[model samples]
Target: MAAEKSLHEYDVILVGAGISGINFAYRLQERNPELSFCILEGRHELGGTWSLFKYPGIRSDSDLYTFGFPWRPWEEQNSIAQGARIINYMKESAAMYGIDKKIQYHHQVNNANYSTSSKRWTLDVTANGSEQRAFRCKFFLMCTGYYDYKEPLKAIIPGIEDFEGTVAHPQFWPEDMDYTDKNVVIVGSGATAITLLPNLAPKASHVTILQRSPSYVMSQPSEDKLELLIRRMTWWSKPLEHRLIRWKWLLVPFLFTRFAYTFPKTCRKLFGKAIQAQLPPTLPRDPHFNPSYDPFEQRVCFCPDGDFYECLRSGKGSVQTGVIEKVTPHGIKLTSGDELHPDIIVTATGLKVRFAGGMKLSIDDKPYNVAEKFIWKGVMLEDLPNAAFVIGYVDASWTLGADATAQLMCRMMKQMRKEHVVEVVPRRSEAEKRTMTEEPLLRLTSTYVRKAKDMLPKAGSSGQWKARSYYYKDIWMAWFGDIRSGLEWVRGV
Candidate 1:
């Protein structure tokens, strides 16, 4: 007979150990100190994207004040921080809260089975790509982020194999590789490509950013002047100064989004002027800086202190806009019949967005398709019992949504324990389903989001069933609102 598998039990199983995971764990332990919880990390270490991505000039696209957790004030002067600093910050947060001790590294959850009868989840986790283990938990919280770990969204160009040059993806950048004096061409005009231009240009023989279409690009200082001023004020306490700076930075993004949506033409003019002001007089602002879509429709790329533009102006970098016809032994050939030669090509293409960390989910041995379900307030899925997944905002800093979701999850779990309930599920009535409209979970117009829309959950038309992206609205609903909305509390099964 085969040996029986040992099952470890816990009150909650928090997935990923990234920013969302650490934040959620911190909130749970802070609110309910007696609750037993463990964090499951797929990778050997923490830091999520910050740790995973080691590409040139990898940094948070959003300002650090908003990107950092609300509980922890970012003391760094640079609003746009390097990847290593962010990773250390996350490590420090985990260590300070004792969250690192609770993390089980290399424990990647492959499948989760929920039993309605027992009101428990049986997780099949693979330890370091082998050695399967079983973990039973009363509540499951998935903070695996929005993208796939193993695969990135790489475009299949014709004759890609014909290229003799070194090709790489930004997602899994080779650590030992060096491009000190080699000519480099980075594909895709998204955040990665934009960031790589300035950083690589200084060292590389020449750096060229090739894109099929343009994306909105703006420049801002690395440091926040207002935060610097606040920090310098000796009369103000550190905590008070931090809170004020955080709120101030938070309002900027919110207002920017509001203005863009409310007055598209006006915002477009303002954005166009900003781009033109940054670029040199020789570089035409038409096709290079001006994007096809309106502002805020897609994410705007930020270049700290016009670093990208400075590289271009200084003749160290260039931008090319054309469709890729094929890749030659020398370099890339454009559809417009323009041939360019480069020593190295980097595919800075977008991520492959995956929901629930691509883990197979089943309810009582029946396979459950999460895409068919409706999202409840962007946290819980309709009719999904004792589980919540973090889906952050596309418009603003992701941590804002993450913090809100964590607060809500803690509140709901506490309410369940207080009421002596074994299960708390957000179920939509048949009438509610018929009356409510369905929409994609993510509203962003980015390529990655568009590709993954079919695989993600849907949002309802109104009430608690709808998923919201606004941080201000979420603050009220998740932080201070009642947990009874659209949730069913049941006694012991």
Candidate 2:
């Protein structure tokens, strides 16, 4: 017979140990010192995405200045960092804040049920593999990121299984796999594929980026030159300089996004010109560099120091635009009768969207489908009590949105404590259901987003339930927005 599971309780429980969860832990601890909390991490390590992904030249597409925690700013000169460095940075932050001790590893939350009678959440967790455990908390916070950790978005390449050459996915990269002097073909035009091209080209005989259509590829420096100039100003302290650099990164991306949306044609022309400047005279900007969508419609892939283009210019890597008719035993066959017989094929297709880490939720024995519901304030779900999840911005550094949400959550928790409220739920009226049109909270037209449209949360046209905007506006709303207007607070049992 199996042993009875142990029961533990806390005032608050965090469901991840990633950047969002670690940041939230700091805010929760600093803002509400009296409240007891614990972080339950499914993985053995702390860095969620950074710790999980292990591929050649895996690094942050976003600059590390804003991607790093706001509390402990990134001190490194390189704004673009590798996955291992990011993991170590996060570890240092957790240790410095003593958040490391509060983490419980190998604790996977499979199901969470909120009881109205008890006004508490009971989480059914699997710890250390098979042993079941139970945890009860007044508030539940999900920092589990949007993508599925266990599965990558399945690339529907016909006859992929028949390929005699080694096939791999960037999500689950095989360690120590050698491709020395071997021709390699990477499928997709996203960040992963772009990153792999330059990284693998030096070692491989040649590399080819196979894509159905091109995405905007921009060149970014690993180190910020403007930051160096700012640091040279002796009037400012190191901390002040760091803050200035951070703000510079934040505003630059924000302004770029605004410009791209406001003047897409102009931005597109500029992007094309920049790309053309890097490409050889032989390779025109028509089919490979030119994108079907405007800039910022989908994410623009950034390569550090024009490395991707440099590889192309050096004749080490190349880009092929076409549809994959089938994967033959030798390699890939294009719909246009061209075939690539590479030694290795890498499917750098996108990620599969997964919410709440795929944990099931229920309230008073009634199942709550997150997909069918609407998100309130980009943090809390409608009709879900004492629960909040972090969803970061697609355009800017994810940490910016996460920290903003943390501040908002802290404010809500403080208000609840001040009023002796046990349960707080975001309640929307029937008029909202009828009048407000449904919109996708993830405002991207990317293939991955389009494929999982039915699974994401709904956004309203206006008001508190409207779709999430840019970081600056969201941060403002977080600090001073309406919190009690559409909320129902229960004080006592």
Candidate 3:
């Protein structure tokens, strides 16, 4: 009863106080200052993944210029920054914009029921994992990230329990745990595993990266040379230099991705040569660096200043490619009959993809499975009313798409206010739904994505219904495009 009295209400309820949530709040505040909104965060703090993951070498795989919010330029010299720096940046943004005051920490939304008649959402929120309270909002903005934060997806190799040493996942790295002068084996070859290599290699006695298959890996410097040159020149102002650098960062990746898709063989050869140039002369370039798939089929792992290669070259780390037979008391046994005797094992296996942060949803008291719905313009769902979710670009920096979605949502809200519309929903025609190509929402070929294909929404053939990965096109379509197309407008419903 006391919890019921504590029930809150707002014009809009934003779930998750992460990067996307912060961006949305800023944009919405800038556009419509009269709107009253509150952000609900499940954790005790903000920063989302940056604050949650405290692994040895946690860092941003994408450059900061594109990954950062477009409204606020990342002024740091390092494009690929460490996790602590990112967390700090997010905190600074929240503080500077006074967004921190609007966030209710430790309030996790357990369920949401949207009533069409009232055109409002009633959320059952669990506070501090015990007290239950209700919240009502006119509109819902889901800024919850794509993956499950509670648990990481760990492959169950045989006899993992038999290992006597400490086995950990990067998602839940213990703060007090020490790995100095110990043999470490990290499982998986994704960005997390690659990031951990260089950082742990220097401290640990030896670090071995075990992968079932290789991922396309590339290395670039932490600082952008072009950006540095622009900064050095006095001809341009700071704003102009920032825009130039941001566009350069954005276009380079976009063009490279297109080139990889257009001429995969040539890009693959170039990728191999780049890897070979950094590797030690004794190590063969065939199985170690060469992956079975084409470049850009999956996201490429970027190492800052070739730190991973330098660590390997220094004889502190090594890479082994094979299937895991089982885990023994001492270490992991490979299918090729090779046994790795390590004191500590870090499972850097992928994340468990969760939609809408695993919040149960119902529209007009009817159950709704988000996976069964289709994505409209990569922002809102096909039939969801007064709600939008932020899903970023899979091919490029996530914030590029996230920023675009935020801007689009703000625009739609403004339009709705002006039109006196009580409810807005994207509706797919029966013909469009029946004839639409039921492709996986994500276009990447990563293992985690493949595993979560069925859990994700479907993409349509073309036009507004299609899920696009290109930031350039999404910027024009989502930011500048009309909001009336494919949307059903209800006036004072």
- Per-prediction backbone clash count: 1, 0, 0
In order, what is each prediction's RMSD in angstroms?
Answer: 1.5, 1.4, 1.4
Residue 352's lDDT in candidate 2: 97
Model 2 agreement with the true structure over 55-161: per-residue lDDT tens digits: 99999988999999989999988888899999999999999999999999999999999998899999999999998999999999999999999999998999999
Least accurate stretch of 10 residues (summed lDDT) in model 1? 1-10
**Alpha-carbon shift of residue 335 in model 1 (angstroms):** 1.4
List runs of model 1 lying over 4 Å from the truth: 1-5, 234-236
Model 2 clash pairs? none
lDDT of residue 167 for candidate 1: 90
Question: Considering only N, C-alpha and C atoms within 3 Å, which residue pairs clash in candidate 3?
Answer: none
Candidate lDDT scores, in order, read: 0.88, 0.92, 0.88
Model 1 per-residue lDDT tens digits across residues 274-388: 8888787778888887888889788888888889899989989989999999998998999999988999999988999898789999999899898898988899887889999
TM-score of each: 0.97, 0.98, 0.97
Q: Write the per-residue lDDT of candidate 3 for residues 188-277, one digit (tens) a residue.
A: 999999999999988899999999999888998987677678778835588887888888898888899999999999999999999999
Candidates 1 and 2, the one with greater lDDT:
2
Ranked by lDDT from best down, the candidates are 2, 3, 1
Candidate 1: pairs in clash = 383-426
